[model samples]
Target: MSEKNREGKRTARERMAAEREKHKAAEKRRRALIVGASVVCVLALAAVIGVIAANAGKDDSSDSEGPAVAPSGAQGEDSLVIPVGKAGAASTLVVWEDFRCPACKSFEDTYRSTIHELTDAGRLRVEYRLATIIDGNLGGTGSRSAANAAACAQDAGKFVDYHDVLYQNQPAETDDAFSENAKLFELAAKVEGLDTPAFRSCVEDGTHNSWVAKSNDAFRSGGFTGTPTVLLDGKNIYQDQSMTPEKLKQQVQEAAKG
Candidate 1:
């Protein structure tokens, strides 16, 4: 072959090699993309499974036996001052709550809407057990004041209303604005049929001291290390941010079936 022809053949071979390299690089990029996508999908699936497992653990932990109860008083009493559900229902759930607990507030909201339906149907009853874990956190005044005010409102036959208002007006967990005794009184006055003077006097004179102490003692005996511990038919129902009205309703329905 002539020299030029030979050179042309060599050039053609080089071009073919360059094209192969390009294809190889493209294949490598495609493989990387596929691997990255697979990793993301696996990660997403793992996250979903983790959330489900965490929720299941929470449900199991909450279903453990609740705190111990004393022989008498608020914890052991058959009746509660703050009526939670309807007047007469076979299955009653008693909630021991701290006014300053955000989780308690969430539980209260869920119960208020859903329990109202159950109560209206006469399928469920609810009772509030005022727990005061916030006392020490709130400079030893907020929790006691809120509990006392609730008791005082009970004396005035407006415990439920007062309880609702307290939860609505609850301050941030990091802040202790609910510590003001005066604010407690203010909330009491807002309850219809509540005589402001009588309620204030009761709060000031510690007329509800026994009730407050009893509630706190019950909370302690119940092995509640935190606020918003719930008791469903004497069984503890653990609550957290993930607790929803649907889950509670399902639990209640299951218990009713038994």
Candidate 2:
């Protein structure tokens, strides 16, 4: 064949291959769209079913006494209670946190810095409830253990500091995670003013077991359906994967201004 003709044929073959690739890509995208649509339809149907089930008056409340203290608007000086920012600060922010939740970890990393700044400036009071709802299901014993240790730290008057540390050093949601009991104790000791011996003993003996259970019970009662659920001034903050620090700051700002 003539060289020119050979080159033209080669180019035509390449174009055909490219066209085939494009066609395959389009088909793949169409299939993906179909799958995504089906998923959305299934989720919507499930949601409706869930609403019916929830309204069916099913008692999912765990058998335990309620939270140690109800979330009242009461304020106290020197009470270990979570502070409500400044006087007349629009809202009380309460976070129901599960240590083993990766999303909670992200929320902590995102909000900790800003919240600290606000707290330092006397602009917001943030309260936390360390619940273990995802314990056995997600992190198993490790989750429960970390929560237990946190409760001990709280008793030692280092709840806020130790709580931050727990979230900071949280392990993955797996069996291997609980192996860090020593690390948890180590972190707890770093909280100044905490009685290390007492904290360690409490963790070892599971002294805060009942309290943790009670907190979990209260978490359910407060309408918390998921971990890292945030309550701003007693209103729920609906969160999604795209929730950002700037958005949270704006929420806080709006709440503070009100």
Candidate 3:
């Protein structure tokens, strides 16, 4: 080959190598970003394989700041559940959820319509057992406080509305926006009569704070190692990769017919 051609080929190879190095650098940065984002919400759990989740319980205890005043109409053991849907519904969806959990919000966003439809049709009942794992793990009272606010809404016969509002306006995974009663009240205002004096008092007094703590304790002790642990008819359906909203609705309808 000509000397000029040889020189040009060598330059082209060097340029190609440099481009490859640049691509490798970009991929490294991308992977680092992904891993860092996951770390914000992942907690290692014993006895669970490949279970990525926010903390179910950290070393610190939940905020047990008051007496365990069960919200009016709450059911289940220790009055830990805020029940929604009809009393005679055939299937019960037991949800161990954290208000501060991003995953919980995602689940709600995905399945809220189907859940509401089933509940409205009286085909499904939901037992929402709130947990404060984020507070216990991430050093904030947002989880417990938000759950308390939702309980307070239950007193006004508007738990589902307020619950949806909170998740709809959920903050970033690490942002503890729900720690403030003012924020809770602000959101409650969007739920029509939910921002009433009684509701505010219930939230301010933390009437169900102890109940929420008890519920969180149950979650940690239940050997279920994640937030948003959704059980349909006593089966952990959230782990089912094929479980979609339509599938869930069909299952509930079938159960209702049985």
Candidate 4:
């Protein structure tokens, strides 16, 4: 009850109060840190999911069994090579292409007529192999869909006509236009006897989707890197840019002489 005793007790009480406030502030800071870290982790996980969703279509060609169907006269499991001429022609030309590829459009534009001329003369046989690498690299289903439709056209015995029309109306590589089945049917109307209900069903049903996959598998199996890959008798003519359209004709002619 003395004055000194009272003052000592009051000072002790003040010290304890100050210590409790410090502990409370430290707890609040720890809780805030934990909350902030949880928010960051949640945001990071959402970003990863978004990336995966964006790339889902890019892996469509990963099926190792190839497509559920293949075009007629498919060579092994790698391609359904639609032939353009007599089976026993003197020269065999194999061409690999992606329908959405600009380079392929250019190649076809330049040499399409010459190829037809030779094929008609029974001097050369050409085989077309489809590829969808553009779809994998560019993140869309246009290439695969277009190739499938092309194979479907083959089923109707109008592969040559439909193939020509596709390149003739090919959209820019970045447009991803061929993903639309309506567009394919619209283009099919340009080819004779190709716009029937059966053709519509085939294209819309994606009846040749498996064929597209098989063709893509064949493309990979061949170990080539890009589209418009032209080979004469299994020899890569464009390996070093040594072959132009004229050069291709000459090579085929020379091969015929022997």
Local distance difference test scores for all models: 0.69, 0.67, 0.88, 0.83
TM-score of each: 0.61, 0.61, 0.76, 0.81
lDDT by residue (tens digit), candidate 1, 1-258? 999999999999999999999999999999999999999999999999999987762211021233322212232363333564555566887777878889888877767777777766767877777766766444455666677677777776677788889998888876666657777777766777775788778778656655555566656776777777676677666644556778778776776676
lDDT of 4 by residue, 1-258 (tens): 999999999999999999999999999999999999999999999999999997664465443344477665555434477777888999988899999999999989988998998899888998888889888778688888888888888888898999999999999888889999989989999998989998888878777787677678677777797998988898877574766777777877888899
Candidate 3 similarity to native, TM-score: 0.76
Q: Write the per-residue lDDT of candidate 3 for residues 1-258, one digit (tens) a residue.
A: 999999999999999999999999999999999998777556433324343233343434376666788888988788788899998999999988999999999999999999999999999999998888888778888988999899899989999999999999999978989989999999999998788989999999888888888888888889988989999989999999999999999999899889
Could you tell me how far off, in angstroms, the CA of residue 257 lies in candidate 1 after the best superposition? 6.9
Determine which window of 10 residues in candidate 1 has minimal summed lDDT. 57-66
**What is the clash count of model 4?**
4
Stretches > 4 Å off in candidate 1: 1-83, 86-88, 239-243, 250-258
Off by over 4 Å in 3: 1-61
| Candidate 2, 97-205: lDDT as tens digits | 7788888998888788877877666667777666666663543456556766776766666767887887787766654364366777677667787657777787787
Q: How far off is residue 80 in model 1, in Å?
A: 7.6
